[model samples]
Target: MPRFSSDGVDIAYFDEGAGDPVLLIHGFASTKEINWVNPSWTKTLLGAGYRVIGFDHRGHGASQKLYDPELYHTRLMAEDACNLLAHLGLPRADVIGYSMGARVGAQMALLFPQAVRSLVMGGLGIHLVDGVGLPQTVADALEAPSLDDVPDAMGRTFRAFADANKADLKALAACIRGSRQVLSREEVGRIFQPVLVAIGTRDSVSGAAAPLVELLPDGTQLDIPNREHNPAVGDKVFKEGALAFLKARP
Candidate 1:
């Protein structure tokens, strides 16, 4: 693992393999390893002859931890990604992001359009406009003394995932709070890059892929059979569809 300063915060990251770059952004309550490496995403991309770059967002993994909700805005996280690319001397790259990572990736496509060649919005769909999927209580769950104290089902799930990752609770709480901004249809439509919206058939959190796909000027959809938000991240269908999209995209 390597570390770099993004603006002022130190971010932990890994740059592996070789070929055209593919930035992998993990989900909320997830790290690069859990979201990408452990799921064989890095392996899959690398095997396809693509370079892989991944990092722990400021409040997650081994990156600098911040407690300010204001600092965790998705745009800021998107900036962090841009900075990572600038740091690596990459003007642009393909992006594959899941859940919160998907939102961050979309922001990158919007704010740094020239820096994103194409995008795969996995585990996210119409929710990009509707709002980030988790209930606000998931943030409250991060504040609970123990997982047992989180009575909300979704809250407990996130809390347990954070605890398992040995995450900084206060930093993640702020991230959940600050990263809730939504992109309007107008905003999403402004994204000019080719986009792939991949969601699970069983994903209630991501809304449907069609509506969001319809919003992108050049968007397509891939539905993972019998999958939910979390499980869909590692699905074979997702990997194949993503690889195929990458191959077909200009």
Candidate 2:
């Protein structure tokens, strides 16, 4: 684990394997290991001859914690990714992001398009425009004194997951708050890079795939049949679809 200065916060990241670079951004309440390693994402990318890069966003994983909601904006997280690339001396790289990470990836393509060669946005769909899947209730759960205090099922599940991960609850609360910011349809359409939007057929949080794909200049969707958000993270369909898209990029 290495640390770097991103917008004044010390962010932790991993750079492994070798070849064309592929940056991996994990989802909400997830670290690089949980999102990439446990799911074999690093293995998949490395086997495809890609240099894998991953990092903990502010307030998540081993990164510096920030309790301010203003600091948790996905745009700021996107900047952290760009800065990580700058730190690695990579002008551009293929990018993959799941759940919360997908929003950050979309922001990266929107705000720093030159730094993204191609984009794979997973665990996300029309939610990019319709508003974040989870409501303010999830944020409230993170701020609750204990998981038991979270009445909402989805909120409780996220709170428990955060607890299991030993996450900074207050910081994560802020993350959930600030991360609710959404990209407009016009903004999403502006991300002209070849994009693959992967989501599970059974995933309700991600919303519909067709609406998102309709906005991008070069976007396609891959639905993992009978899968949901959590289980779809490392699905072979997702990995294979992503690898194929990357290979097809000129």
Candidate 3:
């Protein structure tokens, strides 16, 4: 429930446990609780002797909501993560992010490498190199007055998820509107930190993880067979891979 100012917006975050810090950034339409706590990420990391830090991205969860499309750019969201680390007085910390959060983490590595010790990107893949894979219709779904009218199954699912989370639909639509910027291969190659890209083999939303891993200087991939985007959020394979990757980080 703690909050900090990130570029004048009050962002909510949680800090728990003790030892080396690991910052957890949730995906689109997700709060830290749904993305991290519900999956036992904090408990798992805490048991492993890590201090767990999780936060609600601006306009998501308990954070201040903004209707402006400009506020949701991936770069600004990455700044929020860096600001959180600074606010917590951690010079650098291991980071794990899923879906939209994965892109935010990638931006952090590209823009604020000094504050990141290692990176684990989940629910991301080749689509990351092009742009956010979801279409504008998906954003429309978030703003739709009723899910019954959303014809696309994917859009309906995302809209339903937003409704279940009681999210700010307008803010999420803006996030989708503004977060179209993509990471070039050269930009990804600039990330020299140990990195793990985890995705589900069946996740159509993410494309393939191999292309993304190939772009990272020290990247590796973990594919959770039979799982899809939402179900793959905190898969056991992802957790194990992340633990090992962080443990082996130089």
Compose the digit string of candidate 1's lDDT tens values, residues 1-250. Answer: 7999999999999999999999988888789989999989999999999999999988998899999999999999999999999999999999999999999999999989999999999988888999765778999999999998989999988898888878899989999989998899999999999999999999988888999999999999898999988899899999999999999999
Give lDDT: candidate 3, residue 111: 91
In TM-score terms, candidate 2 sits at 0.98
What lDDT is reached at residue 194 by model 1?
Answer: 96
Give the alpha carbon lDDT tens digit for every residue of 104-187 in model 2: 999999999999999999999999998775789999998888987889999998999999989999988888888887899999
Clashing residue pairs, backbone N/CA/C < 3 A, model 2: none
Give the lDDT of residue 189 in candidate 2. 83
Off by over 4 Å in 2: none
- What lDDT score belongs to each candidate, Candidate 1 first? 0.93, 0.93, 0.90
lDDT of 3 at 100: 91
Error (Å) of candidate 2 at residue 39 is 0.8
Write the residue-wise lDDT of candidate 3 on 1-250 in tens digits.
Answer: 7999997999999999889999999998899999999998888999999999999999899999999989888999999999999998899999999999999998898899998999999998877787565689989998887999899888898899999988999998988888777888898889998889999989989878998898888999898888999999878988888899888888
